[model samples]
Target: MHDTEALQAKFFWFSPGDMTDVRQFFAPGRVNLIGEHIDYNGGHVFPAALTRGVSLWVRPRADGVVRFFSVDFPETIEARVDELEFRPSDGYANYTKGVIKAVQEEAGTLFCGGDFFYMSNLANGAGLSSSAAVEVVTAAAVRALMAYPLDNARIAVLSQRAENDFVGVNCGIMDQFAVAMGKAGHAIFLDCQTLAYEWVPVTLGDYALVITNTNERRGLADSKYNERRSECEAALRRIQEILPDIQNLTQISIDRWDDVETHLASEPNLLRRARHVVFEEHRTNEAVRVLKAGRLAAFGQLMNDSHVSLRDDYEVTGPALDALAEAAWSFSGCLGSRMTGAGFGGCTVSLVRRAAIPEFEEHVRVAYADKTGLQPSFYVSEIGDGVHEQQKEGLEV
Candidate 1:
C-alpha cells in the first residue's frame, strides 16, 4: 500500500500551495484471466483487478480550468472543461479530458474543474488496462467534486464511451467495467452481451497468479485491433444471411458451428475469427464451472487453450508473447500459462505453484530473454477492489 500522507505531500509539491481541499482517488488496472478478444463479440470475459493501478490527487477549481501533472510523464497539461477535444499529442492527459467531457454530457456542466496529479505503478503498454484506469479515476474524481449522482456502473460506461468515442480506441466495456466494479480476492464473470455479472472467488489454494510482461509495447490504436473488429463484423453479416436470429458470433453455439462453418468456409480469415470467438466462449463458460468446482488444474488447462486459440485463430499473440507463454508452459511448476489482454504484445497470466515461484520466475525469465532478447518483468498480484475515494480521518469527501 502507498503512504497516503506521502502522496498528499507530493501533490502539494506539484501544486505548490495549500492542500486543504485536495482529495484522493484510485482505480485499478485489470488482467483478463482466460477470455481474450471475445468481449467485442458479446462473449464472456473473466477479468480481475490488480493491486497495482493509477492514483490521483485532485483539488477542484472554480474557474473551469483543468490542469494535469503526472510524475511518469514529462509535461503538465492544462485545458478548459468546455473545450475538451481529442489531442493525440497530449498523451495520458487525453483520458482525463475525455472523462470530463463524458461527465458533462451525462450530467449538465460541471460546477468546477480540478487539478489532477497522477501516479501509476502499472507498466505502460503491458495490456493491464492503464488507459481504463486513468479514465475511471478521472471520472471518480469529477463525480466526487461535482456530486454528479453517477454510480460505479455508470462511471464505467461513461469511461468506456470516453475511450471509444473521445480517445479513438474501439475498446469494449470489459476493461472499464472490471476496473470500476472489481472486488478484492475475486474475479468477475461477466456476460458482455447482457452486462450481467457475478463475482467468483479466486481460490488458487497452493498456486499463485503470476503475470509475466514481455516488455514489448503494444500500440493498440494503430495496431490491427480495428481490423479484427471489422473482420468479425463482416463474419457476423455473413452468418446473418443464414441464421438471422443470431446477434453475435458467440450466440452460435459450438455444437452448431459445423453447420455454420460451411457458410463461412470460403472466407478463410472471417471463418478463423468466428471460430476463435465461438470456441473461446465455450472455454470461458467451462472455465467458470471448473473454477467454482475447485478444479484448479482444469481451469489452468482452459487458460492454455484460450492462448492457443488467440495465437492460431485470432492471430493476436506475437513472438514475444508466444515465447513468454511457451517458456512458462515448459516449467513443471506452472499449471497453465497464456497470453492475456489484446495480445500482439503484453503480459501472460500463469498459475504457478506457490512453493516454486522463485524457480518459476527464474526459469521463464532466462528462457524468454534468450528467445526474445528482451528481459521480462513479473508480478505476483492479488485481486483488488474497484475505484473509490480514499478516506482519511477528517479528510473523507
Candidate 2:
C-alpha cells in the first residue's frame, strides 16, 4: 500500500462510499539477466521475480459497469463488464485489456460489475517486465472474482496471449510466468520449450541485485525484438528442412553450428540474432551452476560476457548499456553488470557488494551521466512475493 498510495486518486474516481468487497491482487517483475531473445528459440531462460509488483483493490459492482483507474497512471479508464474495449495501440491500457480478454476467453466469467483500482511501483521499461506484472495480478483478481479457473500456468499463457495477439508485441511467456509464479529468494530456470522449470537458489553473499536505468530512448516492442524472434524461427525452419530432425534452436550442437551458420550467412542480422539465442542458452545453464557453487565473482564475469555478446553479436545493446557495464566492471566493488531488457537502451542489471552499494551507485551515476549526458535511475530490489490482499475499512453506498 505504500507504493499504491503513490499512484493517483483521480483515476479511481470512486469515493469511499462506493467501495464494496475487497479482493486479492498479484503481479511479477522479470530480470532478464541473460539469455535474451532465446525463449522464442526454444532456449532456456533464467529470470527472477524482483521485489516489485502491481496490486489491485477490487470489489463487487452492482451497476453492471466495471469502472477502473490506474493508481500508477494519472487517468481513469472505464468500460462496461459487458463492453470492455480494446485499445490495441496503447502499451499501458492494453495490459488491462489483456487480462480481461485472456480470462474471459478461457472461462468467460463476468465481473458482475466491480470498481477496480491498481498500483505498481515497478518502473516501466526498466527491463523489469512491469507490463507483465500488471497483466498477471489483474488477471488473478478477475479469476477469483468470477470463480473461474485458477491455474497459474494457464494464467501465464493467457497473459502472454494478451501481450501477443491483443497487444501485438509477440512476446515470450517468461515475464508473465515468472511473476505469476515466483518464490522469494530464488531464481527460476525455465525451459521455454517444455514449460519445465527448476528453482535455483540465489544466495548472493552480502550483495543484492541493482537495476539502473540507462534512459536510452528506445521503443521496446518496436525495438526489433520481434524481428529477432522471427529470425530465430526462420533459422529453426531452415535447420528443420535440412536435418528434418532439429525441432528447436536449443537442439543445435557446436558441431551442427557450422551447418546452422551456413544457412544464416545470407542474412547477417538474423545470423547475429541466432547467435545470441543459441549462445545465451548455454550461459544460462553455466550461470546456474556457478551460482550453485557459491562463486559470485565467477558468475559476475559470466554476466559481463553475456552482455558483450548481446552488444556485439546480438546487437541489442547500445553505447549507454555498454558504458554502464564497462564502468561497473572497472569498479572493485562491482561484481558484474549488463544491459537487462530489450536492449538498445532501457536498464542494466548489476550484481553489487552490500558494503559498496553507495559508492557503486555514486561511481556509476556520475560516470554514466558524464559519458552519455543522461541521468540514470537506480533501484535496489530483493526477491518479493507475487500478489496478496488485505481487508479494508471504508465508506459504502
Candidate 3:
C-alpha cells in the first residue's frame, strides 16, 4: 500500500495554496492487459488498473458551475452544472463533457457544482486509455463531491455512453469498466454481453507483465472499429432471422460455426468478423483454465495464436504490432506476447520473468527500434486498485 505521504506527493499538481477543508478526490485510468478490440463483439478482455492514473481533487461550489483544471494538460474548463455539452475543438472537454452528459442522462439530473484539479501521466494512444480514464475518474469524482449515490457499474455505463455519443467514438465498456472496477494482482475476465466478471488471479511469482509499444499509428482505428461492429450487427441480423433466440455472436456455440455457413457466405467480411468473436470467446474461457493451472507457457502460446487470429482473421493487427509480438516470442524470457488495444499501432503486452527484466527490456528495445526506426517505449506495471479517494484530513495517503 502507498503511504499517505507518497500518495500526496504524487498529487503535487493539486496545490492547496489558499483553499482549505476540501478533501474528496479520485484517480483512475484506462487499462489494457491482454484483450483488445474484443469487447464490442461481446468477447472477453483481461485488463488491470494502472498504478498511474488520473488524479482528481474536487470540492462542491455554491454556483452551478463545474470549473476544472488539469495538472497533466495544464488547462481550465468551466461548464454549467446542468448544461453539459461537447465542443468539437475542446480536446480536454471531450472527457469531462462525456462524463457529465452520461451521468446527467442516466441520473435524470445532477445535484451540485464543483471545481476539480485533474492530474494524469498516462500518454494517450499508447493503448493505455488515458481518455477513458479521465472520463471515468472525472465522472466518479463529480458524483462523490456532489453527494450523488451511483453504482460503479452505472458510472461505467454512463462513461461509455458519453464516449460513444459525446466524444463520437464507438468505444467498448472494457476500458472504463476496468479502470473503475479493477482489483489488485488479478486479471479481470469480463463477459461483455452479460457484464458479469471474475477476478482471475495472475500469480506470477517469478514473472511480470511487460508492455512494449509497436510505435505504429492507430490508423483506421475508429473506422475499422465501427466497421467490425457493423459487420457483427449484420451477422446478428442474418442469424437472428433464422434463429430468433440468438442474441449476439457471443451466444453462438463453437460447433454452430460450421452449421451456419451459407448465411455467413453471403457476406464474407461479416463472416470473418463473426468468426473471430465466436472463437475468441472460447479462447477467453480456456485462457482462464490455463491461467488457473499456472500454465503461463501455454497461456503465452495462446497469446501468440490470438495475435495471429487478430492479424490474419480479424484483420486489425498491423505490421508493427505483428513484429512486436513476433520479436517477444523470440525471447527466452517472454512467455507470450500479443498486440494490445485497437491495434493499428499500439503496445504489445507480454508475460516476462521478473529476473529477466533487464535482458528482456534491452533485447526488445534494440530489436524493435532497429527494425521499425521507431523507438519503442516500455512500461513495467502490476495490477493496481480501482477508484479510490484521497482526503485532505488523511494527507492523501
Candidate 4:
C-alpha cells in the first residue's frame, strides 16, 4: 500500500477544503527485456511491468463534469463527459480524455463526470510506456466508478484503441498487455502475432534489471517507429516472392534467409530490417529458454546480441543511446546492456549485480555525462502486477 498520510497531504495541497471521497487506481509501466521493434512484425516480445507508474485518485461528480489535475503539469483541466475531445494543448490529460472516449463507446449509458488527481514517478518520453500506463489506469478508474463490466484484458484492448485512434500513436499490444496482465516476479512471453502469452518466472539469481534513461526524450508518434514497421513490411513482401508461404518476417528461417539471401542483398536496407526482425524473434525464443533453464548468463548474452542487432542493423540507436549502452558495457557488474523501446533515444535496460548497482550507476552517470554533456538517471526496476484498483479508504491493490 502507498502511504495514506502522504497521499492525503498531497491531495489536500491540490484541492484544499474539499471532503470528497475517492478511490486510487494504479497501472505499472513496462520495460522490454529483449525483442525490440519486432512486436508488430509478428514476433515475440519479452517484457515485465515495472513497479513505478501512474496513479490516480478519482471521485465521481454529480454535475457530470470531468476535471483533471496532476502534480506534473502546471494547469488543471475541466470539461464535460460529452466534450471529451483530443486537444493537443491538454498534454498528458489527452491520454485520460482518450480513455474516457474509448470506454464511453463501450458503456454509453454509464457516462458520468469525475475528478481525477494524478501523479507518477515514471519519467515521460523515456521509453517506459508511461502513456499506456496512464490510459490503463484511466480505463480502470472509469470501470470502477461506473461499475462497468470489463476485465483487465478488455481494458488493455480499449487502452490500445485509445492510443491508436484517439491519441494517434500506432503502438502494438505488448505495452498494454503487459501492463494489464503482469504478474509480480514474472516476465510475460508474448506472441505479438497471435496474442498468445505465458508468464515466465524471472529468477535473476544475483543480477537486477537496471534502467538508465539517456534523458534524450522521444515521442513514439514522432519517431521513426512507423517507418521501421513499414520497412519490415516491405521486406516481408520482397521475401514472399521467393517463399510464397511466408506470412510475416518471423516465419522466414535462417535457412530460408539463405535461400533468399541474394534477393535481399540487392536491397541492403530491407535485408537489414528483415535480418533484425528474424534474429530478434530467434533471440526471444532463446531468451525464454535460458530463463526457464535458470541460466542468467546466457540470458544476459542474448540481451547483448539483441542490442547489437538493434544498433548496427536496425540503426535506431542515436549517439545518446550508443553512448549509454557502450558505457554500460564497460561497467564491472553489468552482464549485458541494451537500448529498449522504440529507441531513437530513450533508456537502456542493463543486467547488473545487486551489490555493484551503486558503482554501476555512478560509472554510467559520469561516462554518459562526459560523452553527451547531459547527466542520465538510473532506476533498479522491480517486476510488478498489472493495473488494479485500490478500494475506497486507501486500500492497496
Could you tell me which 10 consecutive residues in candidate 1 have the lowest summed lDDT?
Answer: 388-397
lDDT of 1 by residue, 110-194 (tens): 6488889998899988999999999999999999999879999899999999988888889999999999999999999999878
Better of 3 and 4 by TM-score: 4
TM value for model 1: 0.96
Best by lDDT: 1
Candidate 1 local Cα displacement, residue 156, angstroms: 0.6
Evaluated against the true structure, the overall lDDT of model 4 is 0.87
* Tens-digit lDDT string for candidate 2 (161-269): 8888877788888888788777788888888888899878889889889988887777653657876677778767766766787788877766677777887788787
True-structure RMSD, every candidate? 2.1, 2.9, 3.4, 2.5
> Per-candidate TM vs. native?
0.96, 0.91, 0.90, 0.93
Clashing pairs in 3: 4-397
Q: How many clashes (backbone N, Cα, C below 3 Å) per candidate? A: 0, 3, 1, 0
TM-score for candidate 3, residues paired by index:
0.90
Residue-level lDDT of model 3, residues 321-342, one tens digit each, is 8778877888998988887777
Alpha carbon lDDT at 168, candidate 4: 88
Q: By lDDT, is 1 or 2 better? A: 1
Off by over 4 Å in 4: 1-20, 219-221, 391-397
Top-TM-score candidate index: 1
Ranking of all candidate structures by their lDDT, best first: 1, 4, 2, 3
